[model samples]
Target chain A: MHILVVEDEPKVAQAIKNGLLSEGYRVTTVHTGEEGFFQAASQKVDLILLDLMLPGKSGIEILNALRELGKDTPVLILTAKDTIEDRVLGLDSGADDYLVKPFAFPELLARIRALTRRGRSDQVLKLKLADLELDCITRKVKRNGYDIPLTSKEYELLEYLMRHQGHAVSREMLAHDVWQVKDRATPLDNVIDVHINRLRSKIDTNFDQPLLHTIRGIGFIMKTEDEP
Target chain B: MKLVLSFRTQLMLLNTLLVILIYAVAAFFIYAFMKNRIESVELEKLQEQVSTVSTVVYKSGGDYNDWYHLGDQKPFLIMEDWKVSYQTTAWKDLNFPDKLTPGDFNNKSLKTYSAEQHNYLVKINFVRTGIDTMHNFQVVVAMENTEALESVEKLARSLVLGIPLILILAVAGSFFLSNHAMGPVKLLRIKAQQISAQSLSLRLPVINARDDIGQLTIVFNDLLTRLEYTFEQLKRFTADASHEFRTPLTSIRSTGQVALKNAGNVNDFKDAVASMLEDTDRLANLIHDLLQLTRHDAGRLKIDFSKEDLVSHINSVIEELKILAEEKGITISFLHPDTIRLHINPAYFKQAIRNILHNAIKYTPGSGLIEIQLRQEESGIIRIDIKDNGPGIPPDLREKVFERFFRIDNARSASVGGSGLGLAIAKQGIEINNGNIKFVDSNRGATCRMVFPANSAQDDSSAI
Candidate 1:
């Protein structure tokens, strides 16, 4: 997998580069916003590590510029200013994820792996729970080969839950992963509830057995929805 | 002099002196002028009596002997030259006084004089044998003891007594004016005494014109204004810091809920749990610094001093910074034999030294040198020189580097993950323990120094 790190601080950038290189991923590092913009457009990078505060330009501006050019490559913002305003602005500017600095190198590695999971976007994978089967590609959903229609948000949420199958994900994780957004500005669990409700509606409404089960006091789970 | 006593007594003594001086000067000059006028009038009356005798002697065609007595109700004038001369008709004799009167000028030499009944003033005139002027005669003027001269004495008495009374009133007036002049200063004292951190908004009243007191108010009020402004800025900064801190803290906490709910691996859960712990630590540090600053504001920070070996303590501090140094491939060295031990609070003193060392290692270039020197000087002071080859602090802002919440450029980056309270805490700790810390000397980069007394009984074994 190819990743580009756009950070201004030498130590943090070098650390991330060396760390990612050790993980056997192709990593290129750039220190300027203009350089990040040019590299994102011309280079074949699967992911980008962008610092929010930069010398020449801000990471939000770069993120927005990349998005405006229809580059959907996941961009993770690395920042030290852990303020709601910065997080909101970063996500709203089309960043895939946000991570505050002074972070453990292990967390950075986890986020990089999570971000590069899209390299397998085209691989065929079917998620089956009870009678519900979702085609990973072709956007097909069926109940015993009977077709079902799902909205864009429902499909994305179902995809995220099925990717972490057999386990419950809280409202926050669901919000960040499925919504690709920060927590504060969006009414966090409320959006998660609406999308989960709609996904359950398309997948479980009028079906004989429900596959999306709500885990009380925690979040939701995509399982057989059976007691056993 | 005692403060309050001096303030009141100096004015009181000055006013008494002034009033007494004015009374003495005015009474003395008035009495002298009145007495001189009275004496001049009395002398003129004596001269008139002498002239009367000369006129009578000339009218008598140079009589050899005669008696002349001028009779009034009380005879005040008599002229004689071995005889008496007067125009004593039967009507004059019948109308004259039979008893002596005070201040009446009389002489008995004009006839069979009765000295027992006469109260007189006498004057003798001399005549030379060769001179052909009018015959010399003796004259006396005894004015009756009448109220006319007594009125002069009464006038002098009134002035002597009345002058002091008026002076007392004038002194009282001076005291009143002085008190009135101090009115604004009293208000200022009250205003100042009422000021606390809670009520820092109150300002000194500037109700008067620009005298020294008014100028004092201007300066004092300016101090108050600055204090209020700093308080307000501090309040806002704390709010901003808290608000900023809560976001990341919330993120970490919420992320924990997810990690716990999912059947995630121990490694993944540990990552999430570690982030939460880090956030809590940062939050705790922020609150701790804020509390420390509050204590400083209250002036309540105290230090307990004891034996501290600078050499051993510094080695441990350097060892503490070694973890950070190892990350960057930088090294710290002590260039001098550290033979210094002083009395200090070991915990806080060590904290100050560790902060300086940590900052040196934090800011220095990779493969750079941090040199520490400890030397004892003749002035009874132990000085520590901690120098680093790094990007030096800009000349303009060296002092500001120690202020709370003060950070230079790129201070908030991951490369320098300081809480921005290290130097502030170090300086505060240094001051609490009765030591002085500052940027002592810098060469191509920077050198900072902290010095304190070296004459204490704390042993120096760790230096070797």
Candidate 2:
């Protein structure tokens, strides 16, 4: 999947691009309105991650300009403002979705996947890593075609990690991605960690090779078993 | 002055004192004048008797005239002009301390003569002897005394004694009258006590007569009418607050339920999750804004301000919101003067400025213009103006746009949720700091301007 990120701040733009690149999405970054507009109009992108404030042209003008030219590629607004007025104008001006800045990376990946999954129907219901297969509609998971029981929180956590397979996912990222509430602290009882531990036991304990890898000091990552 | 302990008691005492003063003075003069008149009448009668006897005595020359005491015959002498010249008259028969001598009696201012050993007041006058008025020696006599004089003294004493007794009666009468006069005041006090913030529906009682108390009752009832209106407005505000709070909660819950129901596949689930995330951010913004508005309303807008780099705070906020502006193709540039450090409550001030910027960013079209400038002018005013190229406010509503729950008809929506407390909170925050916020003169789009007292570091003088 291809995505265009237009942000005025270089550091945030770099972070988002780097984050999305490792998630297997082709990310193109720009810092100015002229460049963002050039990229949005000229580049064949699956999604556009745009900012509202830019140099040559404001984000709203670029968005409306793109719509004026009838480009239907999905554009996701990444803003640091969460005002109602901002959201309305963003969506009303032809943005497919609006996402504020400093957002969780996993949420960005999810939005990218959802926005780019236009013609791929069969890819919607199935998820696989190593011999583990999750039948999303049926709410069931199978390892080596054998059923595994998982709690609701454990399953949601597993799905978030698998969706960002082979990449580091932080506990904070998981809380935001799974819970979707900002600054919402799910109590310090090791809730997310406990669920991850349970899922690790289910997906790796009986197998000859463990697929869920714990990245020390970073977070956890899931990969095909036997990679190391 | 004693406190009177009771208002009515004091009034009663004062009224009785006035009445007793008048009664004593009147009784004193009446008794005195009557006693004097009765004594004069007795003297005149004695003088007549003396003249009659002297006429007889003068015809026989050098004869003395005398009379007996009324109802008791006793020796007495009547000399010239009713003057008593007695050896012992019935009036003077009782023990008297002194007596009258016969010669040069006119030289004495008064004489006491013993008549039956009683004291009598006498005066001597010579009658005419054949044309020599001065040499006449014919005598007529009478005793000068009356029970009326003594009785008048007794009567005055008896009436004067009744002064205190009348005063007591007047005091009791005044007490009842004063208590009756104050009856309505006590009633009003009781009524006032009963009517509190909660029971504003209660009213002061009004009596039938159109008197002073009636006028006061009318005034109090008008006051109650105003209080009830205020209470109703308070109730409406509470209801509006609850309704505003419930909306964001509803949005969040519905979003969560929608996402959870459709977690069928990766793409479907991802779309649901994204939508839920959007809803979540909205909910958080609402709660944060609500708390900020409440704090501002409580007069603590400056409670959170701290000394910080004003330029950096503006830059950081702009950088944070950079992506949002990018999406809308809007330009948010900061032109803050160099190292303009200010003592500000970061959270509250940011919230205030953020809300205004949000309005500008939201209403302006993609690629629309927005400019944020913070600089100090010569008069120690730090001005912050946020301007945007959006559909500006209608002229009529520009004044009322800062009212809570108010929405500029062209600028608000339920979709991109707002509690309509953003500008209201901003206005409140600025007002608390003795600063001001206003709509700058503009032909198109909205321009919000804020003026703060310059920080000490930025001001040329030490007055901030």
Candidate 3:
């Protein structure tokens, strides 16, 4: 996946760039609204991470200008201004998603994945890792060709983890992305742990190779046992 | 403290005093004129009585005893050659002055005399019956004036009594008039008193827009509107500032927590610490900028200004920001007269120039040209234009750029290391030195122009 990050802060841009690069995605970053606009207009990318505050032109203006030019690329707004009005304006101005600044990298990556997946309807909507398979259309999970019954939240958690396989996902990431909880300080770590344990017992206990692994203190990661 | 009367009370008292003065003057004139008329009419009647008495005595051929036929009740005394020749029956018991003589009587004379607690009008007539015979007789007739005097006294009494009554009525009338006139003002006072910070939208009732009180209320409502607008702006500014402050702090906290929880090696720890340090630095910068803004708003910040070459100052700022420009591969060029002198605080001037230049360098793409041009106009105003070959600001947002905490591009500005106070601070700094700064019309790029008077008399020591 190719992603364009239109951000002005050098440190933040670098951090996001590093995070996205480590996620195995090709990333292009621009520091100004005008440059961001030019790149978005002329370049082909799967998704664009737009910052509202920029030099040369504002993020909304760029979004509007791009939409006016008939560019249907998915856009995710990342900004420090998290007011309700700001969010409404960003969404109303053709942004596909809105994320406030100081966001978790995992949550950002999750949102990016979601936005990127929205445009590719022709591709198969299934997730697979070794013997584990999940069909998005049927909302079913299978391991070694055997059906695995899962709750909606467990399925969502599994899907998110599988989408970001081989990477450490924090409890905050799970709470924010899967549960859609905006406030990260809430005590949901035990709930997430309970659910993850339940999912591991149901999916990995009866299997030869474990696909879900705990990163101890950090979060959880889903991968084949032989992989890292 | 001096005593201050309320507007309503003052109006009432003034109106009452004016009414009393007018009524008193009118009463005085009426009383005087009535008294004069009464006295003249009484004297005229007394003179007619004396003339009748004199004709009767003269026709009687100076027969003293015949004067009794004129009127028995009327007091008359005829004195001839200093001797009482005839006296009425009523004058018999009356004591007459022994010095009564014809010399005391002119052709006809009328005078008032009080006798036995009764007012009398005395008329005396002197008659000489033969010119050669020299017979002179003084006939005196006295008539009681008690009725006319009683009527005049009654009128005087009524006047004395009516004046206070009229004044009392006048007082009541004036009070009512003043109260009615000030009714709208009273309503305005009550309504204005109810307006607090929370109820800024409430307006004083304007009953009559053409009246003075109504006009005053309209003006007050306009002032309230302005105040409310300012309050809203202040609230928004505070909210935005708090949000801006919270974002970086949240980043630092979250980054630290995640780093501590997830770090499994030295490299991970180093990377986490580096990110946390970056967020912390951003937080520190935000706080510093907020503090500076607060100080400036409170007028607590002092500026030290001296006469210096403005061209060199701009060059120094440009040189300082050269590394930042070089990082983006943007070229900055300066064009100015040889030595353009201006009176300014070097620090504040440099800060202002640095902000504009930084914005230019940050916005312009790599290999884009940034130009700084300084020229002295014929009007003795020094102008500096900072133009950038970047996406210029929209026309509608040109003026809003100076607003506190206002960012055109929220997302890009966040990453650009701007707290949204750079232009606001720069505008304030330039204004403090008696200069003007604004975004001028440019065809292709953003042009920010700062104009300063060649000889600014405003010094840094003075409060702005």
For residues B360-444, what per-residue lDDT tens digits would candidate 2 score against the true structure? 7778888988988898888767788888889887778876788766776534467444667778877875665446798877867
Candidate 1 lDDT over B1-464, as tens digits, reads 65556564567667777878878897888888987787667657655765665455445544534434344443433334434433234323333344323333343322212243432333433222213445544333333323435667898889877866877787787778678877787888888999999999998888754788888898888999999999987896676566647766787879888898885897787778657755654664565555565666696544456766778888866754564565567777885464566767776677788778877877788988888888778777778888989987887778878876667874343346656677888897787666778885577567888877654434443321
* lDDT by candidate, in order shown: 0.69, 0.69, 0.80
Of the true interface contacts, the fraction found in model 3 is 0.00
CA shift at A60, candidate 1, in angstroms?
A: 56
DockQ preference between candidates 2 and 3, better one: 2
| Clashing pairs counted in every model | 19, 51, 16
Off by over 4 Å in 3: A1-228, B1-10, B47-75, B88-111, B115-117, B123-130, B133-139, B301-304, B453-464
DockQ of 3: 0.01
Ordered by TM-score, highest first, the candidates read: 3, 1, 2
What is the C-alpha lDDT profile of model 3 across B1-464, one tens digit per residue? Answer: 99899776788778878877887788788878888998889878778878888787677666656666787777877878767887777766455555675456543476667767787777777777643355678878777879888887887788788778877887788779888988887787788899998988788887888888778888988999999999988989989988988887898788789988886798787777767755654564566566566666887555766877988989977755675676578898999999877778776777788788877887898899999999998877889999999999998999889888888888787666667878887887788778999998998789999999755733434433
lDDT of 2 by residue, A106-212 (tens): 55766666678767773557788878888787879999988999877678878878777766676557756774534323121134555666688898899987878
lDDT of 3: 0.80
DockQ, each predicted model = 0.01, 0.02, 0.01
